[model samples]
Target: MLLPRGVPEAGRLAAFNALVRGDRATVCRAAEVPLLDQVDLLWANGWQPDDVLHHTRVALADAKQRRLVPDLVAADRAGRSTQAIDPRWQQQLDDAGLGDAQARRGWLARWSAREGLEGAQLVLAVLAVVETLRVPPLDFLLPPPGRPDQPLASAASAPDRADPVLVRVRRLLAKAESTEFEAEAATYTAKAQELITRHAIDAALLAANRGRNGEAPTMIRVRVDPPYADIKNVLLNVVAAATRCRVVVLGQVSMTAVMGTASDLAAVEALYTSLLVQGQHALAETARSAPPGARTRSASYRSAFWLAYADRLGERLREVTDHVVAGSTDSDRLLPALQSQADALDAWVTERFGTLGTSPVRGGWDAAGWTQGRLAGDTAKLATGDLRPTRRAIG
Candidate 1:
């Protein structure tokens, strides 16, 4: 039973007692039917394997519930033919460890034996997972994978494949995230920003030259988990802004829906991920030097620090993007193409999430932390130059 909110303790206990008295084997078998059905419903409603698993882990905060989800998803997917499965969708399933585990014929028994689950524990896990799968309709961020009428080729082919620009940028950002020295990290990050901005410009121009019938805009949901999720959302928002993307923060679910062309979305994801790593590192370093009296409010300090960092980095990244765009040899064409893309994307967002209300951020702030974070952001390198259009791109 999915416990409706605000159910009194006595009512809750009664439901639990009823479940406790049920025959365990029958319950498990019966539960699987609904669980598989819910998985199918969610897939159609735009919930992916990773998104559902993440919701279970964060919203439910139950390890048993989380463990049961992959098996349920994989088992449901087992019935679908390989040709019907999009490669990108398969990759998501693989990322969640659902690949190569589709042997669902005896999954219930195998899962029980593997986890040593039994009796009430097993029943609770099954029921919890079932309830978790009953997710409300979500906007189809990516095209639903198994739809017979939809074109899966575009979703499965070029967009999801490894693009050279992204591969190079990922390597640069990886160095930025791993390096200990602030200057070294900043240089790598700056280089990455330069590359991404240039690539975006080239892509836009190429699309324009091709009569603007290039890859259409799309969406991806990035998890902005808590321990200061609001501040982290700000960081993600800024990254999206600089990369010609828009983000709608779904604070209730600890997720952000980012909409953009595929390449730009990839850039935003990669850059935001690296920046978060760098921000956390800076937070730890600053924590070490905090005054003894101020240590009690570490949460406030971190919140302030990240907020300031996001604001400053937003300004810096935008500056780099502007500089690169201004220097483009094909600005006459590039500016209009970029503006047209932005307009189309704005219209799409308006249609998709009409009349969204702003969610107020709940947190404390520290002036000292803000100062430190601004300094960190100011010191971070973001160099860009020489944006002549490549012959290969335009030709």
Candidate 2:
């Protein structure tokens, strides 16, 4: 029996105060009467009912805006039966200085629309309509219950805690014994190969060219047009990180001595693998969703990809820094070495494209050209022994 419209300003203030003081019951009680009833009571005292109703609704809306409705009944009723008030409701209520439940409902509706919930609902509706028209029988039965949970046995409770396959490979690489290193390396190599093969298969499926050939295509081609260099930059960053890690690992420059931890090699390997996996996923998703004759522009996809990479990089950097700060002999020297690698990577990235600060598509190619010129000049200088001021200095 609560008024479906608004509440009075004085009444709303009182209600709001009551709610703040944990006296929700009082507010709810006052709110329960119809607006007309309250207005009629007021009219008996020579007050205009219409004016009172308008003021009341405004006050009610204001109270609602303050989240002063503490009574579970009112809260539940509002949450369940009402959407949100619209801007119009707010505009109307603003003059009266009250709140309107209908206005709140309208506002919620608008919010849902902005969030694309309405689009989702439309999609569901279309699917339902299609089902009704073409496959009526699908609506006849509910889906079966999901798999039931099983009771854990003692063995399950004490499950084997062997390291992940990748971790095992890293440990094997760290061993001084050639035989041990070879064995673990073989396993790790096989796993990496398998992952690559699986990724190829997925790419083939996504391309929808499965039956055309006995084997999947080795290289998946993508054409990203101008104005989308962000995508390429992000991809390049991932590749650069992986390549640097691999070089450091394969070079066998005593990571513990340089980076302060042999474990850093394993961490780097893990990061490389993750980056590769994520790249493959991104490529696959792009291939699947891209429209026919679509050329990539704006590099928005790559930008999105880099945001995730940046997050991972930040986390890994923190872990590495923490290890160094802990005084771990193998970890303490890693920060400077990593910084050097990062610098090299930045140089490579700049040479390949341009500065990270520049526009991805507009300035990218020009940057790449400039980088190439610099590299050529350096190479020529190196070849002519021009790097050293004196010939003896080089010796």
Candidate 3:
């Protein structure tokens, strides 16, 4: 089996030999394989029980200072048998002065209490800490003996106290309903602003614009400014509002575009509300169809309903297009007008919404056949129209 490029030859040979011997160490050693190379070798060479066991040991040993130890231990507890050490491996612990049942129990108790562990769970907890802690694995095996004569003072013995800064800040902000603990509040605010700026309101608008230009006839842009500057709630409310708004806007536009007037915007809003109600019904239908505990409620329903809504939106766009074409004073004028609306909508959505591919609502157009024809047609018409006015004035 292939090993990582920089892995020492001796290590590889030892791991390979251990695997051949059907030793657990070999599986642990193999787990030390770099993430990218590990899967390739496992699939390519058909990993055997020995290979898996050796790799697990190597992974545990090499996991010094990484979070992988906890995950590895958890995987072992979850019936991933690769992480099991040989029963004889416990003898090695005894050799290291960790063999005494009382010593093992003491160590397990101390480790678990410190890390909130319990029972056989202590094994995985200890292994996880050993795999990740900066100290040597043997340090856990050899703890400094406690001094019984000088009992340690506990926090319960301390006098009632409070930090001066916290007291001062609380008094200063008492009258200010909007103010919070300055340092902690600032940290949370900064994080919230980062997400908002990164997935800015404008950025989402840009993507919506692109989708509109491509083929989606109806789109909505909703801007929300909360009454209070609660940054945490702002992010949650904005994202939720945007999701609901997109569904409403797209549904409305599809129904109204054929009317050739802005009056459809209001009509579309009503239709959007109706669709949402219909969506609720559809969700119930889906839940009834699924077996109990066979699926997650929120995730499965949200995804299913969104997919259903997207299909409905696409069908409406086609229906609107057909209706407009049949009812138009000029068939040629109708296509150009629709194309223009689409381009303007795309640019607006992208500029206002944010970047493409960032939002889920932005990607369904490719599947709907709106990628090429209408965008090209719209651009060509706009360019020609701009030139016509200038040329006529010159003549």
Candidate 4:
């Protein structure tokens, strides 16, 4: 049922139908080996559990097809010893809700039952996951589990979730995302950015003092959802810039490869996610209050709004970062460390993407929407005076 390459569409459909008519249990059992093999192969070839799951959700059409990727990933990881798995790998598994996969025996059967699949549906779901997993190798970003050289744990892991600074940042951003009042949201967001900036600087200084100057850049892909993915890419770029990271957007796959030190990468992802939500909310609110007969509902207006928001928000964030950096007492050591990371990251991006070209964003200009977006961004309360120093912002 794992449709081999070069099979004609008619032949494939016919084969599918024939299998649908056969004993489902036997077909499922037979497909399991190839499916799990494909999953393992993908992991070895630079795909991680979350990466595969995200791609499957985007590339596949059927709900059953989308739902099976993570289950298959869980099944594939069931035999691994906990000690052998990289912490980041395990984090991805847990994020994908597969942390207990090993503890659950006969997961496939249980997943089928839980999802209410039967007979043809079960067979088709298995085959769909198999087909989805069999893609070309991607750029190897991390050491896959089972590799002899895999670093099972490292300082690169995200700051502990329980860290008071991170906990406070998350809290502030949550309020920023959830609040309806623009001023209130902006205040919360500014503080969050302040905290993130301070945390990153602290991490950088710590790394510098530890003489970890040889650390190479690492990468992570953040998904860009559709309708205005191109505009969203602009927002991502701006956030990446302000957060001291770099990005290469592969628009075809709706993914952007972000390169930086581990801590900066984490900061970028967290802040970008919060800002995306806040931008979308502001856009929707604009749509509702737009003067009658305005083009606020048009694609051009929405695109222009996002463009302006990204432009303005980026300016504010850079100002905040600059203000904090200027306030740091350890500029002698801190500046060099930051400069080295940036230089190393630039080289890494050039080597990885080699001579990239710009991606043209779609949609015509909308003056009114652009104005509103800029205003909305300006309201984000990131004034230098308003930002609090988490111990001189970077001591």
Which numbered prediction scores highest in lDDT against the true structure?
Answer: 4
Cα lDDT tens digits, model 3, 1-395, are 32323689998676545444543333334333332233223323322222223334333543321333323322222332333433323232334322112211122233234444333343333334333222211101111112122221111121112433223323222211132222222222222222222222233334445654222333322221122112212222222222222221212111111111122222233333333333334445546766776442444334433444434343433333343345444555445544564455445445533563323332222222222212211221111122232211111
Model 3 error, position 72 (Å): 49
Model 3 local distance difference test score: 0.30
lDDT of 1 by residue, 1-395 (tens): 43344799988777666656666555556566666777778877777777887887787776656767777777877877554776667788777875234654566656766787777787777777776566666776445556756532124223443778788788888877877777666666766777888988888899999997455777778998878898898899899999989989864566889988888888899999999989988887866766776652477777888889899899888878887898899999999989899998888788888977777666787898888788777765454433222221211
Q: Clash totals for all models, in order?
A: 0, 35, 41, 0
Candidate 1, residue 373: how far the Cα is off, in Å: 1.8
Q: Is candidate 2 or candidate 3 better by TM-score?
A: 3
Local distance difference test values of all predictions, in order: 0.75, 0.30, 0.30, 0.76
Off by over 4 Å in 2: 1-232, 235-274, 282-303, 310-314, 317-395
Clashing pairs in 1: none
Task: Output the worst ten-in-a-row residue range by lDDT, candidate 1.
Answer: 386-395
How well does candidate 2 score on lDDT at residue 165? 38
The TM-score leader among the candidates is 1
Off by over 4 Å in 1: 1-18, 81-83, 99-106, 109-120, 141-146, 150-161, 209-215, 288-297, 380-395
Candidate 3 weakest lDDT stretch, 10 residues: 136-145
Order the candidates by TM-score, highest first. 1, 4, 3, 2
- For lDDT, candidate 2 versus 4, the one ahead is 4
